[model samples]
Target: MATTDPLGIAEARSQLGTLVARAVHGHQPTTIRRSTTERAVLISEDDYEELLRARRELEAGHVAEAIAAHDRGERETVTYDDRAALYADLGLPTPGERS
Candidate 1:
Protein backbone atom coordinates (compact mmCIF):
# COMPACT_ATOMS: atom_id res chain seq x y z
CA MET A 1 0.00 0.00 0.00
CA ALA A 2 1.08 3.59 -0.59
CA THR A 3 2.37 5.65 2.31
CA THR A 4 -0.22 8.07 3.72
CA ASP A 5 0.76 11.62 4.53
CA PRO A 6 1.33 12.55 8.17
CA LEU A 7 -1.80 13.49 10.20
CA GLY A 8 -2.39 15.76 13.16
CA ILE A 9 -4.27 14.69 16.31
CA ALA A 10 -7.49 16.46 15.36
CA GLU A 11 -7.47 15.11 11.82
CA ALA A 12 -6.86 11.63 13.18
CA ARG A 13 -9.61 11.99 15.80
CA SER A 14 -12.12 13.30 13.26
CA GLN A 15 -11.38 10.43 10.92
CA LEU A 16 -10.77 7.94 13.73
CA GLY A 17 -13.65 5.70 12.69
CA THR A 18 -12.40 5.42 9.13
CA LEU A 19 -8.85 4.89 10.38
CA VAL A 20 -9.97 2.04 12.62
CA ALA A 21 -11.90 0.48 9.79
CA ARG A 22 -8.92 0.73 7.44
CA ALA A 23 -6.58 -0.62 10.10
CA VAL A 24 -8.85 -3.62 10.78
CA HIS A 25 -8.61 -4.48 7.09
CA GLY A 26 -4.80 -4.13 7.18
CA HIS A 27 -4.70 -0.93 5.17
CA GLN A 28 -1.66 1.37 5.07
CA PRO A 29 -0.53 3.03 8.30
CA THR A 30 -1.16 6.70 9.14
CA THR A 31 1.72 8.84 10.39
CA ILE A 32 0.64 11.07 13.30
CA ARG A 33 1.98 14.64 13.37
CA ARG A 34 1.49 17.49 15.86
CA SER A 35 2.07 21.26 15.82
CA THR A 36 3.15 20.91 12.18
CA THR A 37 5.91 18.66 13.52
CA GLU A 38 5.83 14.87 13.53
CA ARG A 39 4.97 13.11 16.78
CA ALA A 40 4.11 9.53 17.77
CA VAL A 41 2.32 7.18 15.39
CA LEU A 42 -0.89 5.13 15.38
CA ILE A 43 -0.48 1.64 14.03
CA SER A 44 -2.19 -1.74 14.17
CA GLU A 45 -1.83 -3.70 17.41
CA ASP A 46 0.39 -6.33 15.81
CA ASP A 47 2.71 -3.70 14.35
CA TYR A 48 2.89 -1.89 17.69
CA GLU A 49 3.86 -5.11 19.47
CA GLU A 50 6.61 -5.80 16.95
CA LEU A 51 7.96 -2.27 17.44
CA LEU A 52 7.99 -2.73 21.21
CA ARG A 53 9.75 -6.08 20.94
CA ALA A 54 12.46 -4.60 18.72
CA ARG A 55 12.96 -1.69 21.16
CA ARG A 56 13.21 -4.10 24.11
CA GLU A 57 15.85 -6.16 22.34
CA LEU A 58 17.92 -3.02 21.78
CA GLU A 59 17.51 -1.76 25.36
CA ALA A 60 18.28 -5.09 27.06
CA GLY A 61 21.85 -5.02 25.65
CA HIS A 62 21.28 -8.14 23.56
CA VAL A 63 23.32 -6.63 20.69
CA ALA A 64 26.38 -6.02 22.89
CA GLU A 65 26.21 -9.58 24.24
CA ALA A 66 26.08 -10.97 20.71
CA ILE A 67 29.10 -8.87 19.64
CA ALA A 68 31.09 -10.04 22.67
CA ALA A 69 30.32 -13.67 21.84
CA HIS A 70 31.31 -13.21 18.19
CA ASP A 71 34.62 -11.54 19.08
CA ARG A 72 35.56 -14.13 21.76
CA GLY A 73 38.54 -15.55 19.77
CA GLU A 74 39.35 -12.56 17.55
CA ARG A 75 42.56 -10.54 17.78
CA GLU A 76 42.40 -7.10 19.51
CA THR A 77 45.22 -5.39 17.63
CA VAL A 78 44.62 -2.91 14.79
CA THR A 79 47.68 -2.05 12.65
CA TYR A 80 48.74 0.45 9.99
CA ASP A 81 48.93 -2.41 7.41
CA ASP A 82 45.32 -3.28 8.11
CA ARG A 83 44.26 0.26 7.20
CA ALA A 84 46.54 0.27 4.11
CA ALA A 85 45.11 -3.09 2.94
CA LEU A 86 41.53 -1.90 3.38
CA TYR A 87 42.25 1.28 1.41
CA ALA A 88 43.92 -0.73 -1.43
CA ASP A 89 41.00 -3.21 -1.55
CA LEU A 90 38.55 -0.30 -1.89
CA GLY A 91 40.65 1.19 -4.73
CA LEU A 92 41.36 4.25 -2.56
CA PRO A 93 44.89 5.62 -2.14
CA THR A 94 46.46 4.75 1.20
CA PRO A 95 47.30 7.64 3.63
CA GLY A 96 51.01 7.76 2.75
CA GLU A 97 50.38 7.04 -0.97
CA ARG A 98 48.18 10.17 -1.44
CA SER A 99 49.82 12.83 -3.73
Candidate 2:
Protein backbone atom coordinates (compact mmCIF):
# COMPACT_ATOMS: atom_id res chain seq x y z
CA MET A 1 0.00 0.00 0.00
CA ALA A 2 1.15 3.54 -0.69
CA THR A 3 1.95 5.66 2.33
CA THR A 4 0.51 9.16 2.33
CA ASP A 5 1.99 10.15 5.68
CA PRO A 6 4.61 12.85 5.60
CA LEU A 7 8.19 11.75 6.12
CA GLY A 8 10.65 13.79 8.13
CA ILE A 9 13.09 15.82 6.06
CA ALA A 10 16.16 13.91 7.15
CA GLU A 11 14.64 10.51 6.49
CA ALA A 12 13.20 11.72 3.20
CA ARG A 13 16.60 12.99 2.14
CA SER A 14 18.15 9.68 3.05
CA GLN A 15 15.59 7.83 0.95
CA LEU A 16 15.23 10.34 -1.89
CA GLY A 17 15.93 7.74 -4.55
CA THR A 18 13.27 5.35 -3.27
CA LEU A 19 10.80 8.20 -2.79
CA VAL A 20 11.29 9.31 -6.37
CA ALA A 21 10.95 5.76 -7.63
CA ARG A 22 7.65 5.32 -5.77
CA ALA A 23 6.32 8.59 -7.13
CA VAL A 24 7.30 7.79 -10.71
CA HIS A 25 6.79 4.06 -10.99
CA GLY A 26 4.09 3.44 -8.45
CA HIS A 27 2.18 6.63 -9.26
CA GLN A 28 2.27 7.60 -5.62
CA PRO A 29 2.96 10.99 -4.07
CA THR A 30 5.22 11.40 -1.06
CA THR A 31 5.11 14.33 1.30
CA ILE A 32 8.34 15.49 2.86
CA ARG A 33 8.24 17.65 5.95
CA ARG A 34 10.67 19.98 7.62
CA SER A 35 8.11 20.66 10.32
CA THR A 36 4.43 20.05 11.07
CA THR A 37 3.42 23.01 8.97
CA GLU A 38 6.19 23.07 6.39
CA ARG A 39 5.86 20.31 3.83
CA ALA A 40 6.12 19.59 0.12
CA VAL A 41 4.87 16.79 -2.08
CA LEU A 42 6.88 14.84 -4.64
CA ILE A 43 5.17 13.36 -7.67
CA SER A 44 6.04 12.24 -11.17
CA GLU A 45 6.46 14.79 -13.95
CA ASP A 46 3.31 13.43 -15.61
CA ASP A 47 1.29 13.96 -12.42
CA TYR A 48 2.68 17.48 -12.04
CA GLU A 49 1.71 18.35 -15.59
CA GLU A 50 -1.74 16.83 -15.08
CA LEU A 51 -2.24 19.01 -12.01
CA LEU A 52 -1.22 22.11 -13.97
CA ARG A 53 -3.59 21.22 -16.78
CA ALA A 54 -6.49 20.65 -14.36
CA ARG A 55 -5.81 23.99 -12.66
CA ARG A 56 -5.78 25.80 -16.01
CA GLU A 57 -9.07 24.18 -17.01
CA LEU A 58 -10.66 25.18 -13.69
CA GLU A 59 -9.46 28.78 -14.07
CA ALA A 60 -10.76 28.89 -17.62
CA GLY A 61 -14.17 27.63 -16.47
CA HIS A 62 -14.32 30.35 -13.82
CA VAL A 63 -13.41 33.03 -16.37
CA ALA A 64 -16.05 31.76 -18.79
CA GLU A 65 -18.71 31.87 -16.06
CA ALA A 66 -17.69 35.43 -15.11
CA ILE A 67 -17.87 36.50 -18.75
CA ALA A 68 -21.32 34.97 -19.09
CA ALA A 69 -22.46 36.78 -15.95
CA HIS A 70 -21.13 40.08 -17.32
CA ASP A 71 -22.91 39.50 -20.62
CA ARG A 72 -26.18 38.84 -18.80
CA GLY A 73 -25.69 42.16 -16.93
CA GLU A 74 -25.63 40.28 -13.63
CA ARG A 75 -22.22 41.80 -13.06
CA GLU A 76 -20.63 45.11 -14.01
CA THR A 77 -19.41 45.08 -17.62
CA VAL A 78 -15.72 45.61 -18.31
CA THR A 79 -15.02 46.12 -21.96
CA TYR A 80 -11.73 45.00 -23.53
CA ASP A 81 -10.49 46.47 -26.79
CA ASP A 82 -8.24 43.46 -27.40
CA ARG A 83 -9.07 39.79 -26.80
CA ALA A 84 -5.46 38.94 -25.99
CA ALA A 85 -5.32 41.72 -23.42
CA LEU A 86 -8.53 40.43 -21.84
CA TYR A 87 -7.17 36.88 -21.43
CA ALA A 88 -3.84 38.33 -20.31
CA ASP A 89 -5.63 40.24 -17.57
CA LEU A 90 -7.05 36.93 -16.34
CA GLY A 91 -3.68 35.23 -16.95
CA LEU A 92 -5.19 32.81 -19.47
CA PRO A 93 -4.89 32.05 -23.16
CA THR A 94 -6.84 33.99 -25.76
CA PRO A 95 -10.09 32.53 -27.25
CA GLY A 96 -8.48 31.12 -30.39
CA GLU A 97 -5.00 30.71 -28.96
CA ARG A 98 -3.55 27.29 -28.09
CA SER A 99 -3.53 26.70 -24.39
Candidate 3:
Protein backbone atom coordinates (compact mmCIF):
# COMPACT_ATOMS: atom_id res chain seq x y z
CA MET A 1 0.00 0.00 0.00
CA ALA A 2 1.07 3.59 -0.61
CA THR A 3 1.85 5.86 2.30
CA THR A 4 -0.40 8.87 2.77
CA ASP A 5 2.05 10.78 4.91
CA PRO A 6 3.89 13.82 3.57
CA LEU A 7 7.66 13.88 3.34
CA GLY A 8 9.88 16.95 3.83
CA ILE A 9 12.05 18.20 1.01
CA ALA A 10 15.33 17.18 2.62
CA GLU A 11 14.09 13.71 3.45
CA ALA A 12 12.50 13.32 0.04
CA ARG A 13 15.70 14.42 -1.65
CA SER A 14 17.65 11.79 0.25
CA GLN A 15 15.20 8.99 -0.50
CA LEU A 16 14.27 10.03 -4.04
CA GLY A 17 15.37 6.77 -5.65
CA THR A 18 13.54 4.64 -3.11
CA LEU A 19 10.45 6.86 -3.32
CA VAL A 20 10.43 6.68 -7.13
CA ALA A 21 10.79 2.90 -7.01
CA ARG A 22 7.90 2.67 -4.60
CA ALA A 23 5.75 4.96 -6.72
CA VAL A 24 6.52 3.12 -9.98
CA HIS A 25 6.42 -0.50 -8.87
CA GLY A 26 4.26 -0.34 -5.79
CA HIS A 27 1.78 2.23 -7.18
CA GLN A 28 2.48 4.48 -4.22
CA PRO A 29 2.40 8.26 -4.16
CA THR A 30 4.71 10.51 -2.19
CA THR A 31 3.78 14.05 -1.27
CA ILE A 32 6.86 16.21 -0.97
CA ARG A 33 6.73 19.46 0.95
CA ARG A 34 9.01 22.41 1.67
CA SER A 35 8.64 23.31 5.31
CA THR A 36 4.87 23.51 5.82
CA THR A 37 4.08 24.23 2.21
CA GLU A 38 3.05 21.41 -0.10
CA ARG A 39 5.43 21.52 -3.05
CA ALA A 40 5.10 18.54 -5.34
CA VAL A 41 3.65 15.08 -5.68
CA LEU A 42 5.33 11.97 -7.02
CA ILE A 43 3.07 9.42 -8.65
CA SER A 44 3.20 6.64 -11.19
CA GLU A 45 2.97 7.49 -14.89
CA ASP A 46 -0.45 5.81 -15.01
CA ASP A 47 -1.70 8.19 -12.33
CA TYR A 48 -0.22 11.19 -14.11
CA GLU A 49 -1.93 10.24 -17.38
CA GLU A 50 -5.17 9.68 -15.51
CA LEU A 51 -4.95 13.21 -14.13
CA LEU A 52 -4.38 14.59 -17.63
CA ARG A 53 -7.32 12.66 -18.99
CA ALA A 54 -9.58 13.95 -16.24
CA ARG A 55 -8.49 17.52 -16.89
CA ARG A 56 -9.17 17.16 -20.60
CA GLU A 57 -12.62 15.75 -19.90
CA LEU A 58 -13.41 18.68 -17.61
CA GLU A 59 -12.28 21.20 -20.24
CA ALA A 60 -14.33 19.43 -22.93
CA GLY A 61 -17.43 19.63 -20.73
CA HIS A 62 -16.91 23.35 -20.27
CA VAL A 63 -16.53 23.81 -24.03
CA ALA A 64 -19.70 21.87 -24.72
CA GLU A 65 -21.67 24.00 -22.27
CA ALA A 66 -20.34 27.18 -23.84
CA ILE A 67 -21.34 25.93 -27.30
CA ALA A 68 -24.83 25.13 -26.08
CA ALA A 69 -25.12 28.62 -24.60
CA HIS A 70 -23.96 30.14 -27.88
CA ASP A 71 -26.54 28.09 -29.84
CA ARG A 72 -29.21 29.46 -27.50
CA GLY A 73 -27.99 33.03 -28.19
CA GLU A 74 -27.20 33.52 -24.50
CA ARG A 75 -23.75 34.96 -25.27
CA GLU A 76 -22.89 38.04 -27.20
CA THR A 77 -20.66 37.82 -30.30
CA VAL A 78 -17.63 40.10 -30.44
CA THR A 79 -16.10 41.62 -33.57
CA TYR A 80 -12.45 41.13 -34.59
CA ASP A 81 -11.65 44.67 -33.50
CA ASP A 82 -13.14 44.02 -30.07
CA ARG A 83 -11.13 40.82 -29.75
CA ALA A 84 -7.88 42.59 -30.70
CA ALA A 85 -8.58 45.40 -28.18
CA LEU A 86 -9.39 42.88 -25.43
CA TYR A 87 -6.22 40.94 -26.13
CA ALA A 88 -4.18 44.17 -25.96
CA ASP A 89 -5.89 45.10 -22.68
CA LEU A 90 -4.85 41.76 -21.21
CA GLY A 91 -1.28 42.19 -22.51
CA LEU A 92 -1.53 39.01 -24.53
CA PRO A 93 0.01 38.70 -27.97
CA THR A 94 -2.38 38.93 -30.93
CA PRO A 95 -2.83 35.91 -33.23
CA GLY A 96 0.10 36.78 -35.48
CA GLU A 97 2.15 38.84 -33.00
CA ARG A 98 5.24 37.17 -31.54
CA SER A 99 6.13 37.27 -27.88
Give the Cα-based TM-score of candidate 2 against the true structure: 0.74
For residues 76-95, could you state the per-residue lDDT of candidate 2 as single tens digits? 86689997887787777775
RMSD of 3: 6.5
Question: Which residue window of length 10 is worst by lDDT in model 2?
Answer: 90-99
lDDT tens string, model 3, 48-91?
89977876676567657766877899856555567668556444
In candidate 2, stretches whose alpha carbon ends up further than 4 angstroms from where it belongs are 79-99
Q: Between prediction 1 and prediction 3, which has the larger TM-score?
A: 3
Report the backbone clash tally of model 1.
0
Give me the overall lDDT of model 2: 0.84
Ranking by lDDT: 2, 3, 1
State the lDDT at 84 in candidate 2. 84
RMSD of each: 12.4, 6.0, 6.5
Better of 2 and 3 by TM-score: 2
Error in Å for residue 94 of model 2: 17
Q: Report residue 47 deviation for candidate 1 (angstroms).
A: 0.9
lDDT per residue (tens digit) for residues 10-81 in model 1 = 888999888766665775577777867557666678776886687656544643554475589443433446
**Which parts of model 1 have CA positions greater than 4 angstroms off?**
1-3, 58-99
Worst 10 residues of 3 by lDDT: 90-99
